[model samples]
Target: MKIKSAVFVKGVVGPDQILNDGKHKIAFIGRSNVGKSSVINSLLGKKGLVKSSSTPGKTKEVNFFLVNDKIYFVDLPGYGFAKISMQAREKLRNLILWYLTSPEIEHSRIVLIIDAKVGPTKLDQEMIDVLKDFGHDFVVIANKSDKLKRNSRINQLKIIREQTGKEVILYSSKTTEGKNDVFSKIFE
Candidate 1:
């Protein structure tokens, strides 16, 4: 997709604050430091469009980015960061849940970003379960593919697919290998 105009919309903390204009929303979610922002930047064919950070829990609010003025690429806060307090984690979890299950959610599909090297964590599995419970099928992006060997990457992708029962795109934000694939699913 040729992104002629991709601009930051707004970051909201609650479901009620999500854009209610009836635009199709393709949301990105995962554990903290899983390269969610980087994946967004890669998909948009631009750098610094979504801020990438080394620290965990960099994104605290649900961010909305308007893409080509057609759909909204929602950048959600990541889960499962130990550095944050338990209260904060619970709040984030609740916010994520509300955004997923709430009827106001305009999400067409969610891109669940996972670390290619670390594979899916327990919390990641839990999120998958919640999505399934809501009858929402999501696309899984195994990010940071450049961190692992070719064989290991294949094995990890297989494992993730078997576990989630969903498509897992082999992705590297650094190389933008799976950038088009991600957008294809989103724009399909």
Candidate 2:
């Protein structure tokens, strides 16, 4: 699964706008500012390929990126942005739910990102439960691993695995840590 080319395809605000061709899709879902875009850019071995923002809620649409023209990496909108209006928040919630449940999307795998230092939150738990109920296989990527103490990082992975019953790959976009393992699991 060598990545020959990674290109941004488009952004969708609704289910009808999503590109669906039965191609294998890998979706990235997480709270706002969880380093989802950064991970994508880093994976492609390029900076700024997928826009990343310092502010939360900057990404409010589902972004589809075509990878090697063989599969798709969908960047689902981030959740838990307190500053957004209730209406907008609800819309985002619906969009995410639609992406996950839509038969057309049919993602082959999902990557749930979480801030390693902060650990998992209530919203994260809810997302995990939703994936479980949907019967979608997913892997958690604990981002910002470079910000955590070594011992604490290891313990956090343990805690996350125990809580979700899924293995979590520790990662840091800054250091490119865990990048190989993450891609391997997806293409494996």
Candidate 3:
């Protein structure tokens, strides 16, 4: 689907604030500093459309961006920001868990973002395990692929697919690599 317009809809910290107007919701989630915001901005064809930060944990609340007037691209809080206090981290963790497991979240497809160079961290694997335990399938995006050497890029992608047992897209938000594949999946 061609996106003529995309805009920020709302930012929700809990289930009560999640949009319930029946639009399809696609959410991006990953470790802190995993380029989740960059992917969202690139997919929408807008620079800085999603507030991204060089700081590891810039996105704290769940951000909802409306795409094509039919789907909501949800930007969730990044996990594994170790610089923060334990209390803050626990709060963010609870918020993420609540958002993921809540029935109030509707018509949602989860997109788990990974740093291509770093591969899947332990936290990433835990997230995958959680989703599997819950019987939810996710599309894994190996972001920051341009940072990897050409020879290692394919290997990383292979590893991600093998580990997740799901479709993996090698992506570079900077180069817009894998943008079409991601958008097609979102529209699907």
Candidate 4:
């Protein structure tokens, strides 16, 4: 889908009217610093649409962006390894869990971004389990794929696919690699 217009809708920390708006919601989630914002920007063909930062945990709330005036691309807070206090981290974690498990919100799709080179961590595994339990239709995106060598990339994708038991898309925000594939999946 061609993105003619995209704009920031709102950021919510908890339940809100926007969540029940009945728009097709596509949620983006990942570990801190996994380039969730970058992937969103690249996919939308907007460089600064989503705020990406050098420091991890820059996205504290569940931020929603309206894409094509039809769908809501939800940028959720990164789950792990943010340089924050234990209490703050727990709050963020709870917020994420609540959003994912909430019955009222019907997510059209959930994009789970992961570090291509690092593969899925223990936390990523936990998230996979949760998604399964909740019966959410989701996709695994291996971002930062430009950092991997060709041979290693193949092996890494295999490992990630095996671990997640889901088809893994090799993506690179820097090179726009796998952009069309991701776009099709997200909008499909």
Candidate 5:
């Protein structure tokens, strides 16, 4: 699917603020600094379309972006950062959990991202477990594949599949690798 247009629709703080009215949506979820924004920009074929930050936990709110008016790429806030305050982290966690539980999101597919370099963490596994229990259709996408050796990348995918019981598409935002594959899955 061609990205005719992609725009940041809103930054939501709670479930009530999300504009979830039957539009197809796929969310990006991962730990902070996992290159979520970079992938979003790459998918849109625009530089800096979604704010990409070097610092972790920069995306504190749920960002919804409309793509081709056919689907919404929901950028949920990053989690599992160690430097943030406990209360603030709790709020972020609650916001994401609420959105995951929202009825409106029940119909949408989820694209759970894992940084290929770091592999999956405890938080990532927890999120996968939640998604599995929620009984939602989802796919794993291993981002930052450009940083790994080809063999290591393949091994990482195998490890992730063993841990989460889900297949993952390898991708790199820097080289536009796996861009078409991801979009095909999203539009399929």
Candidate 6:
């Protein structure tokens, strides 16, 4: 289950034909600066495929990437702590909520990314609650695991697991740690 090919498809902000295109979608979501784009790029084994940024909230729309010509890897906007205006941030928040709760769209899986060193935050918990309420299958990815020391990494993973109530995979987009584990979970 390797990603042999990937290409950016299109970005949408509201209901559209792409939502019902019958392609299995794997959505990546998390708070701002959680490295969601970097994680997606790492999973695809491409550096610039997903357009990562140091600043948060760069992803303003629901960007879809066609992976292996079979499934769609949806890069959703980061939820919290963006430099954007209140109205813009609210729109992004609503867009994320709609995508997650919409009945017309079927997600094969959702990847909830959290900062490894920071653990899960308040917004992450809200997203988790929404996922639970909607009965969506999801996995937690603790990105930036490389930033933590060995003992800190263990403790952080434990804390994240306890908080998220889901197995948290320690991932490093820089070192590609846990890349195989992530791939298995995403493609399983």
Top-TM-score structure, candidate number: 4
lDDT by residue (tens digit), candidate 3, 1-188: 78889999788886554557777888888998898888999988899889999988899888988888878888888899999999999998888887777766674688999898898899999999888877777888999988999899778988888887878888999998988898777556
Mark the 10 consecutive residues where model 5 has the least summed lDDT.
14-23
Model 3 lDDT, residue 20, Cα: 72
Taking all chains together, each candidate's TM-score versus the true structure is 0.95, 0.94, 0.95, 0.98, 0.93, 0.97
> lDDT of all predictions, in order shown?
0.87, 0.85, 0.86, 0.92, 0.82, 0.91
**CA lDDT, candidate 1, residue 50:** 92
Clashes of 6: 0
Model 3 steric clash pairs: none
> Which ten contiguous residues of candidate 6 have the minimum total lDDT?
80-89
Could you tell me how far off, in angstroms, the CA of residue 7 lies in candidate 6 after the best superposition? 0.4
Off by over 4 Å in 3: none
Model 6, C-alpha of 165: deviation from truth (Å) = 0.4
Candidate 6 matches the true fold with a TM-score of 0.97
TM-score computed on alpha carbons, candidate 2: 0.94
> For model 2, how does the per-residue alpha-carbon lDDT over 1-188 read when each residue is reduced to its tens digit?
57898888888876554456777888899998999988888877879888899988877788888989878888877898989899998889889888887766667889999898888899999998899898888888989899988779778888888877788899999998999899888877
For every candidate in turn, the CA RMSD to the true structure comes to 1.3, 1.4, 1.2, 0.9, 1.5, 1.0
Q: Write the per-residue lDDT of candidate 5 for residues 77-132, one digit (tens) a residue.
A: 88898899999989999888888876665447788889887888999988887777
Superposed model 2: Cα runs more than 4 Å off = none
Query: How do the residues 83-107 of candidate 4 rate in per-residue lDDT, one tens digit apiece?
Result: 7999999998999999999999879
Give me the displacement of residue 52 in model 4, in angstroms.
Answer: 0.6
lDDT score of model 4? 0.92
Better of 4 and 5 by lDDT: 4
